[model samples]
Target: MIQLWTPEITTLLTRFFKANHLPYGQDFPGHIPTGRFSNGKLNPDFVASFLGIKQTVPTSLDPNLSNDAFNGLVFASAGSGYDELTTILTGAIPVPKQLGQFKSYIAKLSRIFGNNEAQNIIEKSLAIISAGTNDFGFNYYLLPMRIQQFDINGFQDFLLKALHDFVKELYKRGCRKIVIAGLPPMGCVPILVRKDSSRPSIEHVWRTRMLMPVLQWKARFTETEEGCCGSGLLEASFLCNPETPVCETPSDFMFWDKLSSKRAAYKAMSHLLVNQILPKLTLE
Candidate 1:
């Protein structure tokens, strides 16, 4: 019943607040929030509202909450992922570390409520995860560590396996409802698009092609300008060009930045969460 990345819900939050603000941080005054990247609301805030729960307690906030107050919280960090490398790669908090924080959350909840109640809360609550683009960008493209250890396919498999294990740990600890996000077309981020504008304007090359989903969501953008084809190359070129002029309507595009996806990309993620992961939670 929890909705995380729905634009419809986000729009509502914007209207209700009567302020054009995103939950994520902005650099400009009155623009950037402390940590969030968006102008007003991030996916988690919107999702918490949609679930009718107050926004979940951030992991960092876990140390300060009363036990009773902790039971209803949802734990989600924007720039985190399953692999330690993703955060180290992105220079953001990694997934395993976040799980460590979750341990504290569980402990806090147990204190306010009895062990049974804490377990019950976690069992029913949903955990949503979205990460991995940074690993490719910050680690692979930027260095030789993971890339030296594994090829593109190998790296992809490694991260997914990491996810499998992370979710399994959550499940073992009482987290039953969980959602995992597949990679979107990251090649079109305004920054990467800009990067591609340099000397290497290659089509469907490993640099860009590797970023698209390997197995899931394969056919969706396969033919579009963002897909692995001649036109896709041209699109990346135009979009990446510093002189190409950035579009205000980022939702119309796929990639938001070199490391994140736009609204459309998140929309695809929402579908997988609802249609695929949600139904499977009870199966756990």
Candidate 2:
């Protein structure tokens, strides 16, 4: 989520983190690094392929890249959240600004592909957003100011309002198909609460429906207690460096760094596409 001076990635950057983080794209073909948390393909890439739009999702900000925006593009920044302060802490692109970028993208497309075609693209395109976690992880939990300003419920409401506004903005820009991923069980995440483990924040009734992917993952991987990178507890971004010892069998681990695991992403997508989202969605 660090403000990048350039969208270009070098081989040296891939090996080291400044070449990009050591394992960000370590699982990709030929180990080519990308500016993402996952070691290989992300959830959007899987969604793109399933929808028959494309094979891989590309970042919209890459200066040297060429791709049809109609298929899909990523405006997501790591560590970014709906909360403005969360982005300020990590120098990430704020959700509001990401929406602004989407608007600008439509304008640019209008110039290149004509107004009707551009509008058609936006109306039909699926907009996927994953937020809320950083608001709690980067802002609320890390700083005392959040504690003073908002109670847990108040902060949750604040984030919900921010999310609501963001979706309305997306609707204004012609996005009829949108999927917003909610926060994970905050009480159990490695970065959030490091206690032995208890029931997570989600209520017992909805737990089965909401956490089916998590249940699926318990059997899918050998290691779920920690990440595949280094200590698997606190390391992320630059802290997860080349010197850090990565697990030999990353596929066996549920997490790659502090936040995500590539294999887990694949696992979740399978459940989502087959049982959760695909049948309900009309991508055509």
The model with the greatest TM-score is: 2
List candidate 1 segments past 4 Å from native.
1-32, 55-59, 62-79, 197-284
TM-score of 2: 0.83
Clashes of each: 17, 4
Candidate 1's residue-wise lDDT over 1-284, tens digit each? 22212111111121211112332223224554333333234455545544455543233433464543443443444444555665453344466866776787678678878899879877777766666766676576777688789999998899889978877888888876767666655655545554555645565365456545521452243322232211233222123223333445443444433333343444454444446555655732
Best by lDDT: 2
TM-score of each: 0.62, 0.83
* 110: Cα error in model 2, Å: 0.7
- Write candidate 2's Cα lDDT for 138-251 as tens digits: 799887887799999999999999989888988887888777676766544444334434545454335334555655754366565566776745676677767877988876
Segments of candidate 2 deviating more than 4 angstroms: 1-19, 193-219, 270-275
Quality of model 1 by C-alpha lDDT: 0.49
